[model samples]
Target: MVTFAIGTDDFVVAGALPAISRDLAVSEGTTGQLVTVFSLAYAFSAPVMAVLTSRVPPRRLLGLGLTLFAALNFATALATSFEILLVLRIVTAVVAGTLSPAAFAIAGQRAEPGYAGRAIGVVAAGLTVSLAVGVPIGTWLSTRWGWHATFVAVGVFTVGALVTVAATLPRFEPVSEAGIGDRLRALRSPAILACAVTTTIGACAGLMPYIYVAPISEALTARPELLTVFIATIGVAGALGAAVGGHIADGWGPDRGMIATFGTALVVVLVWVGLHATVAPVPPVVIMGSLAVWGVAAWSNNAPMNARTLALAGPVGTEAMALNTSGLYVGMACGSAIGGLVLDRFGVTGTLLAAIGIGVCGVAAMVISVRRWPTGRPARGKAGKKARV
Candidate 1:
């Protein structure tokens, strides 16, 4: 639920950009910076905050982070100017950065011996489900009641998440006993570094075309309403894929899971590009089918990535998870920027083609990483002394 709320808050603003621009008397381009700044802020802050708050208990930190998140959303809804809203978005993003990694760490730590992948999958699915469920609902509420209402709704959802987490989550001390220097040193491991690189590249590839999905959809279909259907389809498929990916990670090992999912994603993107380039007037069913596969392939990679990071990082898994989260947001920001540039230089076809190239690079990176660390086992140095699993 906390993941769901934070995901909703991250995505809901895109849907409300136009309304926000009109209300705040700013250009749509200017209003869009809110989304950009949030992503950048979250990307940069996650690892830093994780280290700074290393001594804080997970449950206490989660409660405090969610509380601040809720308050920020409410304050955002009340802000009168674009400047204030932008700052609020940045601050809210920092709070969210603090919450998400802790949530993942808790989920990973609490699970039984072999089931950590599935447990992490369940939590990661919240973000995908938000795309399917929360964003659409928030978008509708904003459309009807004004953009401010969307923030209010997210705030209310956050409160619910806060209460649920506080009641159900166990109180646990920090997972890693490493000093700040040791925590930073964990990033030096080959497997951890590879996992981080693959995560960043995979996220970049997955989100590049998605950020400009509207344009791609418009080019492929005449019906405007199908846009909503397409987004919802990806979200739903992504949620299912996340679960399946986690199960695969548990059964097949995280390395194979990453390889298979990323390889599948490469094919899916290639097919999408082919469909756009060769077929004139692509069938709606074909488009939907392609999107469903793309979503599954794209989102399924997340679980294995998380599992692999946790497996490799050992005692500092939480800090590694924080870095992974940062990579995701950074990739997202880069994807958006790169996608926009490609869209401007070339048409929608070019954008789809660019996604294919990016997906290929991501797959190669995963393959290289897995080959280097065949078993996806924990490291053997000082990092392994207090390994969680």
Candidate 2:
């Protein structure tokens, strides 16, 4: 629930962007900056926070993070200006950054020997569901009551998440009592840095089309109603993909699993782009199916790759998890920003081609990591860190 609440808080903005722009006397582009700001804060702060409070108990940090997240959403509900809202969004993002890493780290530590993947998948699935349920619901509430009310609802959900987390999450001892300098040392590993790069690039490839989804739908086909359906399907596909990826990762080993996911996703993007010309003016079902396939492959890359990254950090598992999560958002922000620019300069097809190129680079990076570190062999244990499906 805490994980889903984190996802919900982030996704709520997508549905409310238009209203937020209008209410704050800002342009829609500026409204999008809200996402940019939050992503930036999340990316930079995630690992750093873990590194800073390396000695802090996971349960305490989780509780504080949840409370801060809910309060920030509450504050966002009361904002009267874009500046205020943007600042408060940053604050909320700081809390949001820890939610996923902590959840995954805890899940990894608690799962039975053979069930780590399933456990991590369950937590990640919550975030994916946020896109399906939270985004649309927030959009609905904003349309009906107002943007402020939408935020209030998210805040209320956070309250529930806080309660559940406090009750259910285990209070585990810190794995590393190292100070900031010590935790930061984990990034010094060349292999570790390579993992971050590939993960970021892969995420970039996946998100490129999403940032300008509206324009892409407009350019590819005449009927605009397919747009909403496509987005909704991607959200659902992503949730299922996350859940399934965990299972896949546990079986195939992390490196191989990521290779399959990233490689297939790259091909799918190219296939989708190639199909677009033929898909134009088609039945909605075909387009929906294509979008769903794209979501499934693209989103599936995270778990196996993430699990591999954490393994490199040794005892400082939280720090590594934080780094990967942060990189994920940073890549999303960069991809979305660049996609917007590419869309303006070259239109939808150009964006697709550019995204494919990024994916190719991601594939190359992952392959290079495999050769350098070869962390695909699973260790025999139910404790410490584990990879995705």
Candidate 3:
């Protein structure tokens, strides 16, 4: 529930950019910084928080983080200037940064043996759900009421999530063995580094087109109302992909799952680009279908990749997942920034092609990781066998 609320808060901004810009008297480009700054701050701060809070009880940290998240969102609802909103976003990012790694670590720690990937996937799926359901609802509400109403809605959701957590969540012992140095050392592992590279590239590919999806939809459909449908399709596909990815990772292993998903995404993007470039009077169904396919392939890699990070880091899975989270946000920041730049210099086709190229690099990295290191989980053929341990 906490994740669901935070995820909504993070993604709902994308759909509300026009309303926010009109209200605040800022360019839509400036409003885009809200996504970039929040991502950058969260990326850089998460690892530090993971190490600092390693010894704090999970329930305490989780509660405090959720409280801060709600408060900051409420504050965001009241902001009168763009600058104020940006600053508040940064603070909210830091608080959000604290919550995710802890939640993932808890999921990792508590999952049944051989089912860790499934647990992590459920948690991660919250973001995709926000993308699919929350963002659209928020966008519609913003259009009807105001962007302020959207933020208030997120705050309200968080309050409900907080109550649920307080009532149902179990207490967890501190990860006293984890330390800053231990966390840093995990990054030096070749497999871990490869996973991070894959994360960056895959995320870049997925988000680059996403940052400008509204305009892309407008170009394709020429009907502004259809933008909601496109957004909803992407979200729904992504949500399904995330859920399926977890089950696959639990069975076949995270590394192989990433390889498959990234490879598939690359193919889907190539087809999308070709159809988009060549098909004059392109059918709306074709464009929407491609977007949905791309969404599934791109998003399905998330949980498996995180599960792989945990497998690689062993005892420091919490710290490793923190690093993984950082990599994701960094990619998001870069993708959004670069997408904006590409939009300015070359236009939408250039942005799409750039993402396709990045997707190829991500696939190559995952390939190398699989060949060079033994992935900790079983292969698809060997899945469901009893553990040797």
Candidate 4:
């Protein structure tokens, strides 16, 4: 639920950008900066917070993070100026950054021997559902009551999440209690660095087309109002894909799972772009189906990615997830910026083509990372510590 609220807030802006721009007397392009600010804030904040709170109990940090998140959303709902809104968003994002990695780390800590991937996937499902369901509902609320109502709704959801988390989540100490040097060393490992690079690049590729989905939908359906449907299609597919990927990771290992997921995404985008560029104007049904496929292929890799990162980092799984989360946001910021530039210069088809190229680079990086450090292959390091998947 915490994730649901955070994810909803993270994505709802995409649907509300036009309304916000109109109300704030800013260009839609300027409104888009809200997302960029949040992403960049999160990219930088997660690691610092993870380290600062390394000794704090996971349950306590989770509670505080959600509380801050809800309060920030409420404050955002009341903001009357773009400057205030931007400041509120940046603070909210810094708080939001602390929640996800904590959730994944806790899930990994409590999960049964072989079920870590599934546990992480279950938590991640909240984010996927937000994309699928939350954004559309927020969009509807924005159109009806106003964009402010959407922020209030997210705040209300977070209240429920906070209650549930407090009542149900078990308190756990930090997994490693490793000092900064240890955490930094974990991040500096060849395999860990490679995986982080792959994750960032892959996420950037996956999100390139996603950031400009409204225009892409407008081009496909010729009815911008129907953009919600296309967005929902991606969300729905993402939810299912996360579920499937979890099981696949547990069975075949995260490496194989990510390779499959990323490879499939590459193909799906290639086909979608091909049809859009050379073939007939694709029908709404076909376009929606392609969006589903793209979402599924793109979003499925996160659980495995998290699991793999934890495995590679060994005892420093918490810190590693923090870094990985940072990478994810960095990719989001980059993808949004790249997508905006492409949209201005090349249009929707051009954005998709660029996504194809980025996806190829992402896949190549993943392949190299896996071959260099095979998933679940025990690596003997300091003091005979075995990095096991």
Candidate 5:
């Protein structure tokens, strides 16, 4: 529920941008900065906050973070000035950065033997579910009531998440009592660095085409309404993929799971490029089917990736997760920027080919990482001591 609320807060603003612009008397482009700042803040803050709060109990941190997050959303809904809202969004993002890594770390730590991947996947599914369900509902509320209503709704849901987390989550001590310097040093482990790099590269590859899905879809289909259906298909498939990916990691091991998921994603994207080349204006059903596969392959990789990072950075699991989160966001930003450049120079087809090339690099990075630390085992280092899952 916490992940769902945070994810909804992150993406829901896109749908409400026009209304927010009109109400706040700002350009839509300026209104869009809310999202850019949130992502940048989150990417930069996660690891730093994790280092600063390393000794805080997971349960306590989650509770406090969610409380602040809820309050921020409510305050954002009430803010009359865009400047205030932008600052509030940045603070809210910092809180979200704190909550998410702790949540994933706790889920992995508390899972029963051999079920860490499944547990993490369950938590990750919340984020995917938000993309599928929460954003749409929040968008509807914005259109029906007002843009501010969407923030109010997010706050309401976050309050529910806070209550559930406080009441149900077990109190766990910090995984490591290391000082900031020691925790930062743990991040230098080769295996940990490799995992982070793989995450960044894979995210960059997967998100490249995703950020430009609208234009890509337009080229494929004449009907505009089908774009909505295509997006819904991707979201639903992604949610399902999260669940299945966990089981794969547990049964096949994180290394194999990463390779399989990423390899499948590469193939799916290649198929998209091939279809576009061979058949201009491809059938809508074919596009939808391809998107479903792409979504599943792309989103399913999250679990094994998280599990891998946690295992490698055993003593500093939360810190590693935070770093992984940062890497994911960095890749997202880079992917969007690169995709825009490619789209401008080469069009949608060029964009797809560029994604494929980057994806190949991503897969190669994963392969090299797995070779270095086969079976997701941690490398020989202090950070790798007592590594789990």
Candidate 6:
């Protein structure tokens, strides 16, 4: 739930960008800074927080992080200046970064030995759930009330998450055996680096259209509210896909499932573009159909990739997963930023073409890396089991 707050905190800002910009006397361009700053802080602080608190108790860290997150949400609600709001959002993410990794590490320690895939999927689902429930609901409420009210609501929920965690969350015993150097050593491995790149490319392709989905709907669809409908539908698809992906990761292995899924997602997005332009009044419904297919293809790979990294790093699984998780966000931030640039340089059609192109590049990177896999033989007979443990 704390992680859910973190995920929603970032996305809700996106949905309210138009409102925030107008109220704050800033450009819609500038309002996106809120999201950029938070993601930057999150990406930069996550690994460091994990390593620095390598010996700290998990429940303590989680509690501290959520408390700070709640405080930051209040700060955002009370912010009178854009500069202060920006700074606070960044600081909020720095503090909140501890939750995702710490929570996963804690969950892994508690999960049934063979149920690692299912356990981490639930943790990862917090991210999905944020998009599925938190962001959309927050956006609707923000539209009804003022944007400040949205922050206040989120702050209230953060307080609730903090309290629940304080009461029910179990204490985590930290293992401090690995030095910073050992964590650094894993990044030097070609296979690990390959996994990280796959994360980046995959997120890039996924986010290109996602960043501007609302705008696309406004431009292409007759009914504007249908934007929310498509987003809601896509959210449901992603959640279901993530669940299926977790199961496949536990069984078929990560690399094959993720790589194949990415390839399929490329097709879905391109098809969505055509459906939107040519399908006339029924575009939203068609797009929603495409989204359901895309969601499964896109999200199903998340858990498998994480599980794959756990297998890849062996004893260093926790650290690798932390970095990989951070890598995914880096991909999201960079992808959205690049997508914005593409939108600026070219129209929406051009943006669609660009997204399609990146999707292809991303797919190529995964295929080549998997086939040539820097330092391992592919699993025999198991067609989609290239993930090495």
Give per-residue CA lDDT, model 2, range 85-178, as digits (tens).
9899888888788677877776765655545666677777877787777766776787678899989989888888889878876767776665
Residues 3-109, candidate 1: write the lDDT tens digits. 99998898776566557868889754455557667878998999999889989998789888899999999998998888888899999999999999988887887
lDDT of 4 at 177: 61
Task: Report each candidate's C-alpha RMSD, comma-separated, in the order given.
Answer: 4.2, 3.2, 3.1, 4.1, 4.7, 4.3
Candidate 4 Cα misplacement greater than 4 A, ranges: 278-281, 377-389
Q: Each model's C-alpha lDDT?
A: 0.80, 0.75, 0.79, 0.81, 0.79, 0.70
The 10-residue segment of model 1 with minimum total lDDT is 378-387
What ranges in model 6 sit over 4 Å off?
25-30, 109-114, 277-281, 372-389
Q: Largest lDDT belongs to which candidate? A: 4
Answer with 1 or 3, whichever has the higher lDDT.
Answer: 1
Where does candidate 5 stray beyond 4 Å? 13-36, 75-88, 141-149, 226-228, 276-283, 344-346, 376-389
What's model 2's overall lDDT?
0.75
Query: What would the TM-score be for candidate 4 when compared with the true structure?
Result: 0.92
On residues 1-389, what C-alpha lDDT tens digit does candidate 4 reach at each position? Answer: 87788889988888787678789998655676787788889989987887778888878988988888999999999999999999999999899888888888877756666677877888888888988888888877887788899899889889989999899877666778678898778767888778778888887788767767777777766777777787888889989988887777777788889889888888887887777667646678888898898888777888888889877777788778888888888888777777777777778778788788887888888888988898762222355332231
Highest TM-score: give the candidate number: 4
What would the per-residue lDDT of candidate 5 be over residues 1-389, giving only the tens digit for each residue?
A: 88888878876775566578788998544565576577678889999998988888877888888999999999999988899898998898899889888888878876665677888899888887876777656666776788889899899989989999888877768767667887898778788888889988888788766656656776766544454466567778889989988878877888889889988988887887777777758879888898889889878898999988877786788889998988886776566667766776777789788888988999899999988887543223243232232
| Ten-residue region with minimum lDDT total, candidate 6 | 380-389
Prediction-by-prediction clash tally: 0, 5, 0, 0, 0, 0
Question: After superposition on all CA atoms, how large is the RMSD of candidate 1?
Answer: 4.2
- Give lDDT: candidate 2, residue 51: 68
Error of 5 at 324 (Å): 1.1
